[model samples]
Target: MGQEINQTQFNEQAFKEYNRRLLNEAELLQTQLTKRCFSDIGEICGYELEFWLIDHNYFPSPINQAFLTRLNNPLVVPELSCFNAELNGVPLPLRGDVLTAISKELSQNWLQCQEAAHGMDSVLMMIGILPTVRQKDLCLSNMSDLKRYRALNEQVVTQRVGRPLRIRIQGRENLDINHPDVMMEAAATSFQIHLQSAQRDAVRYFNASIIAAGPLLAAAGNSPFLFDTDLWDETRVPLFEQSVEIVDEANLENHRVSFGQGYARESLFECFAHNIATHPVLLPMLMDTSPQQFEHLRLHNGTIWRWIRPLIGFDHDGTPHLRIEQRVLPSGPTIVDMMANATLYFGLVRFLAGLDDAPESRLSFDQARNNFYAAAREGLRAQMVWWNDSVTDAKTLFMEEILPMARQGLKDLKIDKADIDHYLGVIEMRVQSGQTGAVWQRAYREKHQADNLQLVAAYLEKQRSGAPVYEWEI
Candidate 1:
């Protein structure tokens, strides 16, 4: 006799058991990570950025999946959405001024992707959400033919059953919209920033950085206006969170779908532990085989969380490495602008790590979370409550305090001055002119108010070729 089972059994008991096991696994992994620490924090680090590709006309192009399939390049990979693509750049070992090297490598990789995409009539542009993305475009047909994407989507929709994903965000005006499917997640595009780290301190530092910096970054108006509404500047922040949210409408008191429970007391282990505790695994493996020996199809159940997800993977030598995947940022007007954002974040992490006090202790986690929301609503106009309970404008804080600190931090690393200025200068001018990518986008929309979302996106595409974003005439 052979053992057999139903392929689609939703065993509540089995689900509960899996959650229990995952919590235990998270604990074990956290312990293992604590045992492995790097001596030089700055010595080893790298990053990955994902963005959607549009045509010369600035509409979502189907070329991304085709390009990846045809090119079959490791540096370039298929993303969840067909219009999406991931750019994997070489890691820069922490040393004197690795910024220049990063810039060069990014430029080369971007150009290579462009060259590959030329035949398909596609070009890459980054924004929080593609303005042209429509309700019709959000269908499953637009999703890339990848296992991870399919698995995740299946888990989310199944978990939701027939209930719609309801989003009620109060911006300049309240937004009360509901999508019958999880396809709304497609509207949330991002400029993902990767930061390499060792196991021991990775989770803690990553959590702290997110708590401290997330709000300020979002407030910079890096992304404003989604679907032609002057909603949250980084509307992706809210849109993504709600798009895949899982909830049981009948059980109102025991609502499962909610924003993060709280801030981490110590490390990323706490965040992971919280995730394990609060949400049931939308995906789980029942593998009867081994890696390099057998295939496994793990059920990647959806979660109602994750602004920044901690990932574990293997290097060429099969050495396990950990990295923080920043998922809240918007894509850019230029690569230089994107790199500037990266340098600010990279410098802040290093600077904070060297400090005596943890940012979490000084700033309430709730306040930090609040800051992010405020920034999204107000952009540079956001007022941050700093020390002495003083309310300083975001532009003042970034220009007077954070920018100088970032400069010193980068200088201490002996980063090439040329790279530092080239990037930071972009940041500086952006702040000085009040012209973030979001602001530029909003302005473009206003100029072409008669045009629909697709036409507005087309206008932005036309504008990208001539001058840098900071230099673009409004």
Candidate 2:
């Protein structure tokens, strides 16, 4: 989806050519894996954080084409909406001082982005959902000027036979609405964490990531309001799911954006095989690249928006590697807060995947999927069935069990002691005080009886303070 397409419309011949290349690439990947041909890149980490561009009044600003040009940073680019932009971190090895190095680099890049936004009398805000966004702001006119995005919108609507997209979210309040295009997906942004695992442990690491989703999201929930109506702690989950739903005659998968069916039993190859077998081609952009590049297979894989996605990438030497992309966390309350979320994720998953026994064996997949939705809806207040099959509140489970495992995981990774203490301390305080971004937003609205404008005004002020969400005053 990052790459631009040459044409928006495709013919039957285009689909046939694309599928032919996809099959050849899938077979080549299988042969390479059977021969153990992939190079082992020990645990490496990266991030893709999405942010909103708001004007002086804190409303959405549609100027990213100009904003990105003025900014002129390759690492930062336009997102689905002109009001949104994404920042990508350079891949770093997960070892001593890596966490601190990530923090310093992010701070530096963010300073440059802020300067560019300031020049245009606009600023950037990183949150799951901006509370002040109106329904009018999500039209096709606001979409970024990219052919791939335009083609994606056309393909999704075509799959639905021209019926308008329906979105019905049930939270503290019921949100039943209809949208004309796929731009409603632009309303929800995320802080996606990526880890390039060793080829031998890819399956275990991928399953461990699925099992860790509930605890991590419960602690990092930041999106509680949409269009001034109170919704789930992270309303982005359902909003993104229903925004671009494709109704196919053969329902191989229920929805494109979901928690997945089951854990990986043999290998991650099954995921790519399933992608080839189940999904119809959305973007049939037949490429003229060699089979080794896997261009057609990759472009097809990009269209499926699984919550935890498997990515295929090449290293500096052109060796293919398997990466686990965790897409469940929201963008932010602060840069440190976002990095702290990364810390917990890397550490806990390392511990879980490296265990002598499999954690997924003790916990069923059904409970894992159920726990995810429960955490999203209730935040720290939700009760989850943990590894021991005990249904406990997410807050207590974190403080007593999950946090300690994460601390041990970081120590095992050989991270600096200072980095562990500072980052984990932020998360510890957050869980202990019960003040995730969602919790703070709900408290502010209840106490002041304020409108959405006032809420956003106060949020921007505190966001500028560089204080963690747990430290914000209601």
Candidate 3:
């Protein structure tokens, strides 16, 4: 989806051609996988941080256009809404001091972003959903000025047969609304983590990532409130799912943006095959690239927003590589909080992938998917079905089993001990104290009588203090 297209207007012939090429590329990819034709990259990691821009009143401010222009940094780019922006981190090998290195790069880039935002009379905030965001603020007029975003909006609306997108989320509170465009997606932002792997290990790592979603989301739940109403612990999950909701008439069970139908049966190639067969091509922009480039296939794959998306990219020498993108976690309450979340995910996936018997074998795909939604809805209080068919609360499971598993995983990867302890300790204190970002925000609202701006101001103050959410005062 990051790649820009030259043409948005497409005829029937264009769509047919693009679809044919996409299917062919999928077949070529399977052959390549069979022949072991991919880069032998080992455990390379990166991230994309989406954040909001706000005015002094803490309301959504549509100033990212000018802000990004003034900043003139390639690492920063526009998001769906003009008020939102994303900062990308450079890809680095997952090894000693990597966590510290990621934190340093993020902090420095964030500071530069802050300076840029200030110049435009707006401040950059890192949150899953801005508390001050209102239904009226998500209009198409506020969408970023980009051809790809415009094309996406047109295509999604077209798919719904020109009907308004309807979103209904039932949590502690109920939210029911309709929008004419996909801008509702702009209300949510996330901290998407990416891990590159060798083709031989890609399938195992991808499966492990799916299984880890439940505990990972439970330990890191941040978006609890939207539109001044308390919703799911991670409301972004449902909000995003509904924002671009599409129903295939041929197959009603599959959606464009989904948790996925099931785990990978044999190899990651099955995922690509599923995408090509099940999903209709939304974007049919003709590209003048070779079959090996797989540009059409990659673009079509980008349109289908899976939770754990498989990616094909090339190294500096143009050697193709496979990557597993983890998309469940929400963006900030703090820098340490973000890094801690990354550490837990990387460590757990590495550990789970090495098991002689795959975790997915013990845990059914339906069970894994159900556990994800439960954790998103209930946070740490959620009970999850683990391996061996045992059900336990998320907090206990993390403290007793998951944390130790992560520690060993990091140790096995030869990560520095201090880096391991510092990052994992943040997760330990957060879960043990039962004070995740969601908890802290909910507590603040109760203490302040639900003043939205005051809640945001307090959050910003605590964020500036550079303390993790667990240590912050209400």
The alpha-carbon lDDT assigned to residue 124 of candidate 1 equals 70
> Which candidate model has the greater lDDT, 1 or 3?
3
Tens-digit per-residue lDDT, 195-301, candidate 3: 99988899899999999998999988899998888999999999998898777435545688888888886678888888877788888988899999989888988
Alpha-carbon lDDT, every model: 0.63, 0.90, 0.90
Task: Give lDDT tens digits, candidate 1, residues 327-441.
Answer: 5667665677777887777666666655667666666766666676677677777887654455688888778777787777677667778877777777788788887766777
Candidate 3 local distance difference test against the native? 0.90
Clashes of 2: 0
Candidate 3 residue 123 Cα shift, in angstroms, is 0.5
Candidate 3 wrongly placed segments (more than 4 Å): 248-252
- lDDT at 248, model 3: 43
The lDDT, on a scale of 0 to 1, for candidate 1 is: 0.63
Which prediction has more favorable TM-score, 1 or 2? 2
141 in model 3: Cα distance from truth in Å?
Answer: 1.0
The whole-model C-alpha lDDT of candidate 2 against the native structure comes to 0.90
